[model samples]
Target: MAPANSSAAAQRVIGFIRRTQAPRQSPPPACPPVKKYKSLTEIMAKARYAVVERDDYSDVLCDQCGSGERPDELLLCDKCDKGFHMKCVRPIVVRVPIGSWLCPKCSGEKRVRSFSQKKIIDFFQIQKCADLKNKCSSTQDAKKRKRRTSLILHKKRRRLLPFIPADNPSRRLKQMGSLASALTALHMEFSDDLTYSPEMAPRSANHADFENGGMQVLSREDIETLEHCRAMGRRGECSPLMVVYDSCEGYTVEADGPIKDMTFIAEYTGDVDYIKNRENDDCDSLMTLLLATDPAKSLVICPDKRGNIARFINGINNHTQEGRKKQNCKCVRYNVNGECRVFLVATRDISKGERLYYDYNGYEHEYPTHHFV
Candidate 1:
């Protein structure tokens, strides 16, 4: 220890000695230095759970914009109760359809009072108006003229009621909205027509274009081939299916009415094998069936006459309930002398040697055209 009062130079040397004697801490562990992600999307990718799907995954994507379409960050409108993105909102106006602006935070008693006193319609009110209109149209009561005319006041009810019965849950407005949305989504899909692979089907696609009048019929040979081949048929080792020709277009035969009486349908050969055994098969190499000309326009097997293959074998029935009810196909021909008919399903255009295809369950209800097999 220095004397009671040390000199300034001596005091400075003592302070330096004390500072050097202080305990040193272990150096802290270094975290791997954070590598910066390149893009804004990459930086915010962790928030994927919060993001909405802008379009279906398989839809054609915009290279610059990533997966999203005309989508924006979600925003709830204060006035209209309508859903729109933050970017889609229109400019502020003096008056909106549903009345004065009030966000969820601002939905106080005063806002509710303003909403009610004003004549603006709500989402539920629209539904009510729709229901009233439907009731007037269905009842068709001239004496109740007010019900027909007062659609606007009951707009919500009228909109809900038009297409089908209320008891049928499937007919509900929400379900229809979902269906419309789904159909709109389908429009985004790249169609087979737009995305054809030429290497895989050059001649075939061109031929279809020609035959369907999407292009000119290429030649007279093509027309002749179309008609001859249009008369399609099938042979059978398992099921004998004769697609007798007929036409039932531009008309819907009533539920109880006769299926045969309706215009055009093909006739079948009354042969027992054709009536009970023709199976529908589509292997291209071996069996070739020929179309027969007769009161019963039938099909034939080229190689054996003894069937090399089968014809139709599905739910579509051979004939009308009045004519025949063959399991697999019972007797297509009820009367030995009279004609028996078989209707065909035209999924594809039948060319020569391509086995003629038909359904066994019933007529081609899916395609509005049905003529005799």
Candidate 2:
């Protein structure tokens, strides 16, 4: 027998106990889901697709230092198909065969071939020159270059053949080869016909005394002596023109050659060495100049950048008592020595192998190679 209000309170306690007894479930997690990654090879595989569109490459790895770095990061060799950084290889032009660019550890191997017992460098083989000859061809490209070169050579010969001091006609060539000496000898045959006497021979074989081969430059006092030589003949001295060995002629050549006196009717062509030969003893007495009767041609002359050739031509042979213009080649006789050697208003841009010659001089280096004799 319980009171009604106490009965209601007992029922409330029972309900609270039931609620507390129920199992507690765990709260849901707050973090996001985990992710998975592809392998390194797979990643690199994707990169290749992007890189394939780029240009050519050598090996995938560096060849020089054996580094594993990619080829694009290194300097690549075109011929060998290898890659190296600029620093990893020896300093040389990457191109060209004679010069070699070697890797740091190329097994201590000699990289370049030997020429004349020396490592080939800059692709030049000087000793080979005597044995070497121009690789001539009948190809259009080769012929065009050859013709241009020949014309230029002919022009230089015309401009410079007369100023050689009467010593050895190409004494310099005797040391070089038989070919050049032949050219010198051929050029001098015209001398006898040209009116110069031939006392300046035998000295051609001597090189040790080559510098002292002829007359010293005429000093101021020498001018008085030259004047005396001219006056020795009497009254007015031999004509002012006779004091010098010059002759002038005019003709039109390629405007691309050297420029010179346009008014005269005779000219000279190249190789200072040739002119030096004429000035030398052997041919000096025997040589002569040739000219054209045609008015369409004129004389021309060119000088070295130093202008020494021009100066020597212009210098007074005090004994002869003549200065430059007075010694003009136009003053000489025609066809007596051969073809005219002068040109006027021609151009001067010579080709790479083309010899840069002048009428009154011969090459320091002789013909054939046009290299230092």
Candidate 3:
């Protein structure tokens, strides 16, 4: 009876131990099934817990001079709340203007119209429309259907194409600054569009100045839009961009607002000279306008003395991932009006305050960008 009691007690104790350990030995409740994320943005959205709002202004300083002196004289940007001294800003605001004023950065953003609202057309289309209008008469009933079909086709092709400059004269002057004066002193004229000199023109009647096989011809609608842009450009209006002086990168162009992919930013404007003449040139912003089959006929654009916002744009270091990530714009050589033209175009959607960077060497990878940031 004593042995039986002892065996039963031992069995009871073992059973109790097994019951307590059963929960721990199980498979961790199957781990609640891991979530699969489709994109980095989704993961970021999930990881974010809360947002902290900033209400402090004790550390405000002038964005231009980096000084907080004469706080009353500092003009706070209505959009960004960044402070800037009246004298430090371009054009030197003598007194506050009548209405709401935006800083250079904010003003740039406001100047750019949304891509959805803007029209992009081809140069050839304008010529076709003008030719048709000159040839067609109001009595030609048969041509009406053809014209209607053409108009419909053009309407279908309408899309957000490129940037339009601001119409405000004061703002335009401020953006151009002393660039014209500097160019004039160097015997160069500031041009916002490509110019063809006698040397840069096609040498022979059969010699083609540009390769247009891959490009699309512009429609009449596109021509009207281009004309409007040209008129604005002639008035010293520029793309919705701001040139900010960086201590490290010198001067860099920044997008004032969101920009869509393939949006035409600016034409690389300068004196078109033979490549042979500029082979030993020290100009860092030289752009290849044409690479003719004949080496002697090749032309390059020298933007050292006269250029628009494109000259200030920095190149990206394609070797590093960080450097490549910084690139938002691309340099594309387009054939416009039987002439080779270089244009800076947006490669991806660019956000406000982001600096523009493009591959300087393009596919050839000739230019060294090791020190590019």
Q: All candidates' lDDT scores?
A: 0.26, 0.28, 0.61
lDDT of 1 by residue, 117-204 (tens): 1121221122232467644553453223335325634664321111111333222333223222222222221110112233322222
Better-scoring candidate (lDDT), 2 or 3:
3
What TM value does model 2 have? 0.15
Query: Using alpha carbons, what is the TM-score of model 1?
Result: 0.19
TM-score of each: 0.19, 0.15, 0.50
Worst 10 residues of 3 by lDDT: 116-125
Q: List the residue pairs that clash in candidate 3.
A: 121-222, 122-218, 125-218
CA shift of 237, model 3, Å = 4.3
The C-alpha stretches of model 2 lying farther than 4 A from their native spots are: 1-294, 304-314, 317-338, 342-373
* Residue 6 in model 1: lDDT: 75
What overall lDDT, based on C-alpha atoms, would model 2 receive against the true structure?
0.28
lDDT tens per residue, model 3, 248-346: 465577876567665667778887788778777766678876666677776777786566667778888888999888888888765445556677778
Weakest 10 consecutive residues, lDDT, candidate 1? 232-241
Q: Which residue ranges in model 3 land beyond 4 Å of their true spot?
A: 1-160, 164-173, 178-189, 196-225, 235-237
Tens digit per residue, CA lDDT, model 2, 270-315: 2222233443232211212211133112122212111111122221
